[model samples]
Target: MDEFNGTEINFHCMYIPFCDARDCDRELYDSPVDCPDCNRGMVALHFTILILMAIFITMGNLGIILVIKRNKIFHNSFNMFKCSLAFADLLVGVLVVPSGAYETASIMMRSFDPTALNRTDYLIGKDVAMIRPDSMCDRIYQEDIGGPGMFLSMISVLSVMASIFHLVLLSIDRFLAVWCPIKYNQRKALKDKCAISMIIFVWLVSITLSVVIPMSLGQRHFIHGLSPAMIFTLKTSNPSTGIFYATFGLGLPYLALLGLNTATGSIILIKHRNLVRRSSLSPSLNSGGRRKDEVKATITILVMIVVFTLSTLPAMVAVTFYNGTEHKKKGDATIRSIIYSTLILLLVSNSAWNFIIYSWRNDNFRKALKNLFTRKQQRQRAIIRWKQLKCSVLLLSEEKRRRKKLIKLTEASNSYSSEKM
Candidate 1:
């Protein structure tokens, strides 16, 4: 079946470029698409990896959500953004990833039969349906409208967008807090209520873009050379949807994150430098204390930004370039499946690493997580968590005191004027 002309083409042959003929002795490749990577042992290994990664991602983020909920220290407005991001990341781990991983693994498992490495019914679009005769991909393609499948499709894009938006929100919050602390505090826009409002806005926008109408009707165009397992996410036939998602959904927000985080980091560094200058001149000043906390937080954010970019951008770029049933037809299953699935593993790796990042960089998060594992030493852990978090609380309380003092002075002046009258 490995045929280009009426005659059968040998799998080991190289194409003679000028002669326009494929031979085993020639330099150019004709046999490379046979997928040396899709051997049973390799597919099984990667399959195991996907499953394990999914489990870790699900459990890790779930722990983060629980720790944030149980601990009072994490209830601060900025930490609430972290909570929202964790929840969105959790949804990706739970709803979007596991099933897709299973589908991908199934595809890989049967990709190259030991009996027939050369004979092929698949690797071409016309016989693509034979890749899975009993697959629900058929049902999905037929508009069978299974609720779970449809929901999964929606959530694949949905959770990622929400996660990205939440990260953007965190960056914006950090930028505001660092670049103009006075203005940031005066507006009270990122107070608990405002944080809740913004979180709700993120989910709403993600739903509208990824699920509500665009994916509501399930207008899917299957991509050739890529498996249905991989195609399930971002399933749309609309050029407009793809274009808009590429431009706005994936593009602008990531750009915004880069700009905001860069600016925020630069500001924090400047402030730290100034504090160091002042501390050197006046040894009595405690100007260096909060700078450590700010720097740590900034570093955590930068780490997350880097992880998000590295994990996600490759998948987006690959899927964008090699999209649709018409695209990548010349390529064999080996290149398509291996590279795409590997990129997906990288993408989901983002969900798994947040707990590690927080634990490494953040003491409050570590303390809260430790509290979940043991019941003893409650008071010590509480003190530790409170110490880590109370600086921001003290600053907020100090501002409230100033506002109250201003209001009292105004009231006294008005009362004195009334008495004089």
Candidate 2:
């Protein structure tokens, strides 16, 4: 990473000590990058991680939605925003995860016969081109499918961007509730409508910024590897656009999230401390307890926003900094596979694991999820038992009919024999 922009060329390729039986150990006598075992193993590991993350995200967010829907405790503006985040994450699971697995497998299986670092591209003593272009690199990951691919890519961008924007909205919600309590309560009747409106507004803004703007005015990017759909900028040889997108698109938003969170937190803590100091009784009294609970909830939500945003930062940085050089395109297949896959996994992880956080932080959510699942399991069991009992009754009735038929047949046979005699 230190020499990421350096002019020095590294010919090294990562390799295992030996190919395992899982990949049949039939690696060609080529470079490590050309080893089928590496490709297979990489695909298996990456695909598993992506699929697992996808499942967790789908089920977890769905659980959050169900818990919120059924449990009246979470039926507020605050939890509505949480639901918005959950919905955005659901898109990531439904759209981005499968794409990531496909992209990873494609990238892993792809290898160039001859390294692209040759002098034909004229990258001699001069620095290798830092920005990788879609034109130069093979479109192994979701670019070749034409209309559907582009549509999926747009949705992918929308998903991640919507998640981030929802977090920002959460911060703003916290800021308003903490810093302006009187107004916040006065607007209580409108909060639900406002929250819904804000949710729609946030998604609109995300689509505009991530999809519309990019489509209208392209920004060159390095590598996005088709996961989390966190980024959708196209690439060119121009380096400045990538830098600009990274700075304004991701960096500024990240800093703003921090600023809003920090300011809101500081105000809440300071006010709480002052109240505690001035109060005649301990902060555990009814009034103080309510205040503490509100503060705790605010802080918890803020922590969630911070963590969700922070989880995506490293991946954004990693993808933004990846070079689009021919050498990077071909020579660093294995390296890129690991780095891009891990970064993509990081991107989707927050969306996937938010339910755990919800369960851990809020008792209501935990109890709700538990009750929902438990009740569902009980219902499923009851249905199965009912089905079994019905089948058993059916079998008993069938046996009785057979016995009656056998007796009738014997009586008829005896009558015929007596008549004949």
TM-score of each: 0.67, 0.67
lDDT of 1 at 334: 36
Model 2 TM-score on a 0 to 1 scale: 0.67
Candidate 1 lDDT over residue span 1-421, tens digit each: 3442222211111111111111111123222122332244544565567567768878888888888887776776678888778887787777666776554444333332233334433222232322212122222232223455566666666777887888899888888777766655565646778878988988898888877765444434312112232324553445776777777787888889989988988898787678678765754344345556666777788888788889888876765554323333334533455566667667767777788899998888888788788857577778888987898799999999999999999999999999999
- Tens digit of lDDT per residue, candidate 2, span 141-201? 3242345455555666677677777777777777777787767756663378888998988
In lDDT terms, which candidate is top?
1
- The residue-level lDDT of candidate 2 at 59 comes to 92
The window of 10 residues in a row where model 2 has the poorest summed lDDT is 11-20
Which residue runs of candidate 2 sit more than 4 Å off their true CA positions? 1-39, 103-145, 182-190, 218-248, 279-284, 324-333, 376-421
Query: Which runs in model 1 stand beyond 4 Å of their true positions?
Result: 1-43, 101-146, 180-189, 220-231, 276-286, 323-332, 375-421
* Candidate models: Cα lDDT each: 0.61, 0.60
lDDT at 10, model 1:
11
Clashing pairs in 2: 132-324
